[model samples]
Target chain A: MQERTVKITNRLGLHARAAARLVRQAGQFKSAVELKREDTGQTADGKSILGVLLLAAAQGSRITIRTEGPDEERAAAALLQIVEEKFGEEAPDGLF
Target chain B: MDSSNTSHSRNSKLKGLAASPGIAIGRVLRLDERGRRQFYYMEVSAQQARTEIKRLREAFAEAHARLKEIRSNLKGELGGQHEYILDAHLLMLEDKHLIAEAEREIRSRRINAEWAVRNVADRLAGAYRHIKDPYLRERSADIEDIATRLLTTLSGHTRFNMSTLDQDVVIVAETIWPSTVGELDLNHVLGFATDTGGLTSHSAIIARAVGLPAVVGLHEITKNAGTGDAIIIDGAAGEVVLRPTKPIIRTYIEKRDLDRERRVEASVRSSEPATTLDGVRITLRANVELPAEIESLALFGAEGIGLYRSEFLLLNRLPELPDEDEQYQVYRKLAEATGEHGASIRVFDLGGDKLSLDGFEEEKNPALGLRAIRLSLKAQEIFRTQVKAILRANSHGKLRIVLALISTLDELRDAKRIIEEVKRELAESGAVHDPELPLGVMIEVPAAALMADMFAREADFLSIGTNDLIQYLLAVDRANENVAHLYQPLHPAVLRTISHLVRVAEKAKAPLELCGEMAGSPIQAIALVGLGVRTLSLAPASIPLVRNAIRSIDQSRVRALLAEAVKLATTGEVEALLGRQLPRQAPQFFAALSSLG
Candidate 1:
């Protein structure tokens, strides 16, 4: 199992578009992935749009990326990267 | 006007169609047409949830079809962007989170699919609303949309799915279709009131035939009705009182108690033969459809199943018809269920208006076209399969196969010949079957009634299907609301035809049974009994009322009325004669008939 915590730096937080992007990224890996809010401890399936949106991880809020199974390392790395990239949204600095 | 009286006092009386006749006061089981279900799913059992899962899947399929239709309409007229949204909507129909989550809750939490769907949607909606992003919050509307569609489909199925009732209660609905009424729980559903339909509608006919008290055409009753509001339905008076005052409720209770006492009194006669006052014995039988109805016959203490429609095997059985073995199983089940009492299995009466078989072309006027025995004869292989299967089943139990729609002597002869051929084939093959299987004809057409004597001379017995007889005799389609009034059972021509059939069948000493909606009515039963037609087969639910009607009858007086009934000029005169004579001769029967309305 692999886990990582990262702050949501997207301008609009973990909104529908960002959640969709995250779900698409997580669905690519052959592993069971989940997301949990650091503040509320809310859990959601990483591969589900509705589930990810339910985490309500706003901008600047830290969320934990947890993955398990044979591809947990790659799955956790990809999900963590999407959060760090601000889910393709334009950040305040406009830097990747 | 003879129906069960509740209390003399009444308030807020609402008139509707007198669909079914009975007196019932119960907590309302209202279905919210708006799909705003207020109930929770936590108490639903696993079995219920299992059904709910199936319902959810059905809702999905329904949504797919609806979305596809919308897309088809939006084709070319709308741009690609709208089509993309529709495609997404269709995809959401199969959303694992939306459907699978609801299924999980149904199994794990033991809640209904509707409630679970709403629950999951609510939680996700709450999260979506909490999200600071406007885009994510807007997605909540999509979840609400999907939830609404699923709930609508679930509610739609239950509105007509009468088998889901866990307890006896009055059904309060905005409107009910004839087909929906056909699917209701005949045994448990005490009565119903709808926002539409009149006395001659199919719902009313079925309700009256099944002996359920109903009041229809009560517009907006569903809006005011709740899940368990106390309701009083006066089917006889065509009135319904919702949330009645205490005094009115007390009066209804007294009325219901008295009716219950009378029912208890009637229980003793359930085991007795359906003999009238003059020692004229009658055979009270049931019209069997689905094989499961055999239990209902036994429950109602029916002497036998008179009209077991074998066509039910072919109708709606697309892709593949039941082979000889499947047909044999159903035939055997009915025969065994009937016990010592005989089972009459009508040959497949497919084609025409009933149902179209493979390769059978739809006719311009199906009722007058090739149907029943005509279609069976044309499709000899199909007819032979049914005959051979019936013969095979009779070897196990007391089963008699009757040929339906024998319009002419030639058709009867041909049908008889086929039966002989099947018998020979069975003999040559040394197959186990009833060798001496007696064949009969269903006397529905005018030609059959006219030749009742000739047919009875050779045929084993005759069952008069008055439903078809009256319709054909008057040249009126009883199902057509426009001509429904002309589809009178008391038409002078019909009474003469029935009187002739009874006299002929009696002189020949061949068995006879009147199996139709006509025989279900206490008033009509009196007239038929008076006409010297001793055997009556009708809906199983109507057995008690018909039996009570038969017991109350003085055969001698009815026989006298019959003599005058035949001399009557019009259908109105015949009705007037029976209406005046029945209540006077058999007040108890008339009172019971009042309750039947």
Candidate 2:
């Protein structure tokens, strides 16, 4: 299993729209990804947007991710890529 | 000049209205070749006339089918009424009497089929002009609609409604129909100047809905605007300028762009939450009426939908109930749209501004009548259907259910009992639904806010419906234009109620939020955050400004201010303190929103 604790840098933290984008990216990998808030220890399916949002991880909160599969390294890397990039700096076009 | 001083009758000009609003310096495309627009029925045997009628019927059927398909695809965007309008057209055109009359006229007059169709079209169109209901009367276009269809079928050509004229055009008409609005190419169109319609009328509604600039109720505009005449349409001020000077045009153009840019920025910034300078967070959500409104969440940056106002399904129709599945579809869309943050759906808050009950005869007062939680108590079945739908949609995303206008603990208890009843019903029916549904109440009336401590202990959460809370606490009917000035959201009494409720909620460690107009207003939002209100629900458009205000404040100082403001004796004293402290931190938002008071 690959695991890492990352600070939620995006102003919104891991809210709904961000979770959706993260889950979409996570699903691209063959690895099974799971997220857990550092403080609450609430576990969520990294690929299910609903499970991620229900956690309500606020801005500045820290969360940990766990991955297991042949592509675990790639999944963790890509998921971190989105968090680090701040989901492309702007919300998706036509979001409203 | 008066009939050579003998007849004493002044000459008058017949007014054939240009119906669509616009002033254009283009060649008159007067639709004058009425006969040429249609194909004539050839002089043939009775048998051929019958066959020709059959062919026309078939053509009409095909056209109706196509129109229905177009209407169905557009149902979500244009709403159900548009489809009904098309259906009305099909029924009127296919009326047996009307169709047979035209065929009879064709055979008897021994004239072309074009003349016969025109005669029938004119009669039907004229009948609609006198109908009492304005919406129905406007259906006269259905006759013109049929004529256009027949003309297209007969002439093997389609007439384009939009003209690419070289000169500037300001549309002047009695009323601009939606279809005409849809057909026009706005590139060459300057603006719409209409003779009739108030702010909420169809033309005004459509113009606002479609981002068009329009000024209505300009009487005699048809006579005022001439071909090749220059005109300026000022929709904001409801004025039309004829032969405007170059400087005036330049000034208007600048104002138009500035207004457009501000609106664009507001929309763009709407999608974020309010965070204080010290990083204190406040939830900002949108108020929506339809499922499609969910699409705006990202644009508005709302945390979730604060007020769902689910009464839409029950209002404006027969008092029939909507089943769980139908309600689930709407709730699910909202829940899903909030992405992961989820939405708070206030169960059908009917009665205040809306009336759907059958037995509630005319009352001397409606604001204090049986409404909101009271109505739900009366209509158990209607209430259960809403609860069931909400519970079912819980599987889709984060969903919280709140009951509005709750006044007593007993009301909350009674609502809980009904929710239990719905749970039992859902289980007995083996329906798929979330078993654990967290329910809350709106702390609006003074009694509710005063006793919120007890109710917060009973319910999972509480949402302060500020609009009602302010009105009820101050004994002000906000809708009454006469006393609307007294609708004070920042009143110390209202703030104290909020402060008390938040304290109680904090003691119980219960979730609490505010879903009211006050939650969106700049000064009120700052005061709310000062009172420790972390979650706020507002209109989508207000999200950015509210967020900007929150981001500019120091949370600890705000708390201190709230502590001081609450101790004040009167609402006026509290208002004075807030006026001094808040604007210093958020001068722009405070200045813009203070005028709203």
Cα lDDT, all candidates: 0.75, 0.66
- Best of the candidates, lDDT: 1
TM-score of each: 0.63, 0.53
Off by over 4 Å in 2: A1-96, B1-253, B266-273, B567-577, B587-597
lDDT of 2 by residue, B173-237 (tens): 55565435444565656566665554433455445333456666665555455434456565545
Candidate whose DockQ is highest:
1
For each candidate, report its DockQ versus the true two-chain complex. Answer: 0.15, 0.00
Cα displacement (Å) at residue B544, model 2 = 1.4
- Best by TM-score, which number? 1
Error of 2 at B40 (Å): 35
